[model samples]
Target: MNNHFKTAMDQVKAEEALILRTSSYLKNVENKNVRRNHFLQKGNQIMKKYAVAAALAVALIGGGSGVYGYYKIPVNYLSVDVNPSIELGVSMSGDVVEVEGINEDGNTVLEGVDVIGTTVEEAVQTIVESATENNFIEEDGSSVVSITTETDSDSVSEELTNAAEEGVTQALENENVEAEVIKSKIALDRRDQARELGISPGKLNLIQKLQKLDSTVTVDQYKDAKVKEIMKAIKDKKKEVKADLKEEVKEEIDQTIEEGKTEIDQTIEEGKAEIKQNVEQKKSEIKQQVEQKKSEIKQKIEQKKAEVKEKVQQIKAKNKNNGTQTTVESTTESNSQ
Candidate 1:
């Protein structure tokens, strides 16, 4: 049993020694990330045997908690890129997988944050809250935040960027700090320029140079750009796009108004034609009625004239008969006398 214990002690010491040597070469968080990634990949292959060995060693040394702290980090990761650069990774279970950032005034804001969840916004908010709690940004100071994901898929990147903007805004409100926030689906290819004692992830393109971030750009123009340059480029591009949309909308409105005017003019012309046709038909009907009345009056006048002439002739004939009778009576009286 004593021999077995000695063997376990020797194995644990050997593992500890190997870890320390690798740690010495990790000059900064980025270097540490690369090396830690390598170890994770290697651990996967040898975990079955290593776990058995580690378990035996732990049993002999009675340090389970110490062993757990070394192995809880996961492979999923995210990186916050801004004037201050940070690489934040998470576990599959949404726990703190890995976090890499600066150690200075405004950049080291996320040192002791507890980031858990699948949302980019929440992570950003937590970072701001951490900063706020530490008074990283004063009430009069300004800051900017940008977010990127490990997934290179365009759709995912867009979603995460949108969430990040909201998250940063919330963080500012929570911390009572005001600042302009920009969202980028594309990751910054650079790191921070924080001066440190040893080797680091190298000088990243920090966005602190973008106090004047009002320039024009396209997605293609932004490849591998510094954070400040990307800011200016995106702003300029959006302005152009907005102007184009406004022109298009204006043209559409003008076209609709012209069409309505044309339709109304046609309707008025048709109405005028219809009114003229109705007036002409009415005039023709009135003329026909007048002609019929004139024909009836002429016929009636002719009939009345004929009747008057007949009545005059009848009276003259009657008078002639009465005169002959009177003359005969007078002659008879004379002869008798």
Candidate 2:
């Protein structure tokens, strides 16, 4: 009986040890399953985050690409061609230059003028006359004005000589004819002497000199022979002097004409260049303006996309937190049950 009781106690002890071992194994298996499930949940969360990031990146890249393309496209295209039918006429004389354009329509006339006269009075007079005839001058006479006058080489020379002769003759007639004849003859002889000395006579200077002569010569008769000699000398000298001066003036005018032609050509070329530059500048400015507008639009689109992405991230975070809290509450309720 004693041996049997000992054996029974040993058997009970073995059974209890087996039960403990089984329980430990089962607990280990359960822990391992929980660990695996946790790992899977974490992996799924990471994958979701990556997906969101990829979408945002794609959106941003697309927006940037779209903006680039928009700007790349040409916004303003300008085409320029010279119109052969459109005639631009330029007329120049002395310091006056006039430019006029004839368009397709007969009534259409575009004109511009620039004058640089030796004297301010001449410039102002020419501008006023041209403006008045062309109706460019306003009623108030305070408008931008330009005028041009053309005179041929030969015509200008003739006119100058005639003006000088008339001026000289008029001064001689103004003095007393009989009494001052002697002094006049002396003056004429002096003018001839000047010519022989290679001194060129100036009309204005001669007139001034004659006006300064003594008034006593106007009533004197004793100097008649001397006066006759002076008059004859003066007449002969004037004819020769006028002829030489005309030749010299003609040569100068011819040279001036050649220079004027060259200047006019240069002016036309410069005007065309300026027009081309302005057109190019306008085209570039328009293109830049369009590009700027496109850039603005692109930025706005990108900002909107970013805002949307931010909102989506916020919603995802809220859902994740709520799910975690609900799971924790369920676990607590199960333990309580």
**All candidates' TM-scores?**
0.48, 0.22
Candidate lDDT scores, in order, read 0.55, 0.39
lDDT of 1 at 43: 33
Q: Which residue pairs come into collision in candidate 1?
A: 190-204, 191-204, 215-236, 216-236
Error of 2 at 305 (Å): 1.7
Pick the TM-score winner. Answer: 1
lDDT tens digits, residues 1-337, model 1? 3698889777765577788877876644585366435433433233334545655676567665635533444333355544445555543223355556633423566656656433456777787677667655446554445455543334444444565667778988877777655544333232222223211121122222222243332223433343444555546656766888899999999999999999999999999999999999999998999898988888888888888778888888998998899899999889899
What is candidate 2's lDDT per residue for 1-337, written digit by digit as tens?
A: 3698889777765577899998997777776466434433332233334435555565588865543332222111110001100111111111112222222211121234343222222323333333334443334423321111111223332332232233223323332121121111112234344334332122112323333342233211211222223344345556656778899999999999999999999999999999999999999999999999999999999999999999999999999999999999999999899
Judged by whole-model lDDT over C-alpha atoms, candidate 2 comes out at: 0.39
Best by lDDT: 1
